[model samples]
Target: MKIGHYTYQPGARGGIASYVRRLGNAQADIGHDVEYLCRNGEGSDLPSVREVNGDVDLFETAQQRRLDVLHLHRRIRHLPEHRVPTVRTMHGNQGSCPSGSRFLKRSGRPCNRDYSVSGCLWGHLIDHCGSRRPGNVVNNFRRIETEHELAAKIPTATVSRFVKERMIRSGCMPDHLKVIHSPAPDLNRPPAPLQHKDPPRMLFAGRIEPKKGVEWLLRSLPKTDVPVFLDVAGTGDIAYMQKVKALVEDLGLTGRITFHGWVEEADVYRLIEQARAVVVPSLWHEPAGLVTLEAAAVGRPVIASQVGGISEYARDPFALQVSPGDVDELAECIDRLALDPERAASMGQQARAIARDRFSMDDFVSNIMDLYRSTVTTANGLMRR
Candidate 1:
């Protein structure tokens, strides 16, 4: 089968890029020809990238490639006349909410105010959905429209049921939308044995954005009685970054919290290896908990916000969950896990077991291939008719 993966970004900067790389490799390993259609970025040397920057590149150049399945990792402009079968993997909440966080900035919480012209406008004007700028609101409406168009036009897959439900609530057709959990990392290269730390260090490894709730985590530190250190390892907006640093300094947590900025995937795992627990304090309904899954693969328990898909995973015997933006609860969790290494180790074991059993790359590839084949067969049938 000739399969091509498409996204706006060319490089491995975020979780979706990791998804593309992992799935592309698996498809190629099975002898199915694989290609990635994206605009080349400055920092990456990824292969099979057809460096075009806009809809023209995808509509004209991507169509010329004549792929059996053009799997999109995000929403893009596609005229109704375009014929190639496409499947979109909803990696985030951008398609459903203007903020992409589904978080109401006015109230400072996750919102379910459905995607509507008035609702979106009100969100921007009152809630600060994405930005307060009217221009950004106009663009967000257009993006939502594109999401609806693509959702109605082609097959759609989401990384989590939580995200799928959000899209459906925003008027995406429920008939074709499906949930296929993201793949776990290659765990076959010999497992990293579990080793607990003495003082305990919690790791937060993602963009320090509005939705990430890093500031909330920082605030929680003042209440925690434990001597544990927090190693924050990702970068984002400069102003927010400064605010975080200032907050850290104000709390006199300058000695306890270290900003490692952006680190490589190898370094992430290495840090995970030495850490006591990983924290995913996302204030938004995270489309999927890829980092949590990654930590699970490394035999580390995550203390994630009990919102979005993390709640779904937290329903089981893995990952400590706290209410989003709850500083006291989070502080307690830190104190509990940091002080008692045995329970943390036990949860880590459950995490490793869950990652291996439920989130395997083999299962991920099989489900995606099945969808691709079905989409191809449907396209062929239409042509024959």
Candidate 2:
């Protein structure tokens, strides 16, 4: 089958971009002809990218190529109506409000709750009538309306059950939505051997955002007795990053915390393997925590926030679940893992076992192929009728 994957803004180094890149590669590996139609230049890693300089006349090219399926990875409201089958994966709640919030009023910090009725209504009003800036108001309304239109028009796919539930609650058709967990590269490469170190190392790999709960993790450090060193990686809002640094200094944890700017994918696995445990302290309802799976692949146990789809994976023996943004509980969990060397090792082994069985790239690729084949066959049958 010939498939065309479309993304508007690529190379953001986020999960969505990573997912498309991996899916494109997986499609190639499975002997399917796939092309990534991206607006933000050509992807260096993916061999199947067809970068378009402008939005004009792109659908004509897809039609000319006779692409069987067009999968949109990003929001493009101006997408031309196509005769071919189209699938849109709703990665998050990008329509109701800004990609981050569900309400119009600013919290002055990130709010982590799932969509609320009042929040949604407030956002809609602010977008349509309340905002004084006419251009901004019009843009927000258009974006939201486009999302609703796309959801109504296309066969939608969601990355997690959490996201699917949200869509259903927001009045999307359940029949049109498919829940396919995003795939991650199988890091079958043997993990670096554990070193006998004095202080156990904890790793947090993600953008340094308030929603990521980086500050929560930092605040939790004061209660832990073990000599815990946190290696924080990734970048985000400059102000938030500065706040994190200030908090660390205020707590006199300057020595314990090290901020490593962005690291490449190749090095991430090694870093995960080296760490005693991985922490995913997300304040929000993370639809799916890919980092947790990545850490598990490296035989590293995770201490993650017990919210959203994270609970799906964190129930395993290797994972320690704590309430999101609970500094005391997070600290205690960290201390327990750090103090008990033998237990931590056992958890790591268990985590590796889970990763191999449930999250193997082979299984991910096969399941996705099954979905693609089924969708194509159904579309063909409809056309024949």
Candidate 3:
């Protein structure tokens, strides 16, 4: 079958970009015709590509290609209902929450209120869920409303049940939604021997945004009984990074923390392999913590927030789960893993087994292909009627 994927710039570093690249490549490898309809086509590893430009309408291009199914990773307005069977993958809470994160800033807790103009406006201005700029708030509200409308029509796949539940609250039809977790990268070699750093290193990889709860991780570092060295592996939100840096100094943890801004994917895995534990202390509702899965795949014990999909994997034996934004609990969990090398090694082994049993790329692609075929067949039957 011919599959067309509409996604971001070629070889972008985020989880969504990595997912699209891996999925498209796997589909092509399995003898399916896969083409990436990307904005930037240079440096792509895929076989067929067409750079989306303003000169040609995207719907027109997809129709011309005559793709059997079009999979969307980004939110585009006005999905075609006729010839092309379009399937949208909701990787985050963009359509459901105005801030794109179901987190309230002032209260520092997950916001459960459905999207309403007055409620979200109060959240932005009073609760501080997002920017206070009137124009920015207005734009976010409009975008979410538009996406929610489109989600009702198109077949939608969410990265986790957490995301699907939020979308349902925001008016997406329950019948139209399906939860498909992101697959872990194929680590071909056997799990490496657990590397215990001298000071018991903990790795935090991903964007350094406020919702990521990096500040909370910094706070937890000083509270841990053991002297845990933290290595932040990616960068995001300049202001938030500055705040985090200031907090490290305030807490006198400057010596223990190192900021390595936005390294390559291979380097991230290398860091994971070297660290004693991987920390994912996201304050927001993570759709599905891809880093948690990656860390598990690398055979490192994960210390993640018991929020969203991270809770699904962060069970006993494989990982230690902490409540979102709970500094004391996070510190205790860190201490538990950092001080006990034997237990940490045991959890790491269990994590590797979990990754192997679940999150295989082949299984992910096969499931996606099934969804595509079912969508196309359903659409054809409807057209005939």
Candidate 4:
């Protein structure tokens, strides 16, 4: 099958771009003709990946290439309306929530209300759900409306059941939505050895944002009897980063935590393998936690928030779940993992097994291929009719 993957950038940076690269390459490896379509970038070393020049239209490119399927990872204006069979993967709550984060600031709980001017605006100003910028607020609502329109027309795939439910609440047709869990990265190695050193070490990697619950993690540190050293990697939201840094000082956790800011993907995995455990303390309802999947792939036990689709993977012997924003519970989980070296190592082994057996790349690609074929067949039937 000829497949064209579309995203905002050609170079892999964040989760969507990384997934696009991984999917395209994996499909290519299995003998499918794959190409990447992007707005603009230096493009990558991958020869199949190409940049859509300013003059070239995105839809026209798909037509000229005669692509059998166009899988969209990012929201583009007219890509879904093309003659090509298109499948849009809803990676987050962008279509349903104006803030793109279904989190209520004051209460620190996931918001279920569909997008609206009055309610979301109140959320921004009063509840502190998202940005307070007047222009940004208006633009976000318009973006959500556009997203809803596209979702209604095309086959929309969500990363998890939580995301699918949110999309349904936001008015996407039930038949239009499909839940496909994000694929686990294949580390292709046994779980990293547990270095049971003094002051047990933990790692937190991903974009540093308020919704990420970095503050909650920091707060939990003081309560832990085990003085676990946390190494935070990845960067986002300068203002929020500053707030977290300040809180580190305020909580007297300056000596215990080190902010690595941003690091390459390889570096992240390296850090993950070195640490005794990984922490994903997201306050928001994560559609599916990629970080949790990565930690599992590395064969490290995870201490993750129990909210949203994270529970789907970060469960049983793989991870110790704690309620979102509960510092005491989080700290307790950390101490349990830290103090018991044998249990932590055992959990790491189970996590690796989970990654290999349940969320393999081959299974992920096969399921996607099935969805693509079905979409193409449906489109062909409509054309014939």
Write model 4 residue lDDT over 44-145, tens digit each, in one string: 766666677532366678889999988888877554344789887898888778888888878877676766778888988888888889898888888888
Better of 2 and 3 by TM-score: 3
Off by over 4 Å in 2: 9-12, 53-56, 78-80, 95-118, 121-138
Give the TM-score of each candidate.
0.94, 0.88, 0.94, 0.93
Candidate order by lDDT, decreasing, is 4, 3, 1, 2
Instruction: Give all candidates' CA lDDT scores.
Output: 0.81, 0.73, 0.84, 0.84
Report how far off residue 187 is in candidate 3 (Å): 1.2
Inter-residue clash pairs, candidate 3: none
Model 1 root mean square deviation, Cα atoms: 1.8
Report the number of backbone clashes for model 3. 0
User: Candidate 3: where are CA atoms >4 Å away?
Assistant: 54-56
Model 1: lDDT equals 0.81
Regions of model 1 farther than 4 Å from truth: 80-82
Evaluate model 4: give its lDDT.
0.84
| Tens digits of per-residue lDDT for model 1, 154-233 | 78888889888888888888878889988778766544655566678899999997778888899998898887898989
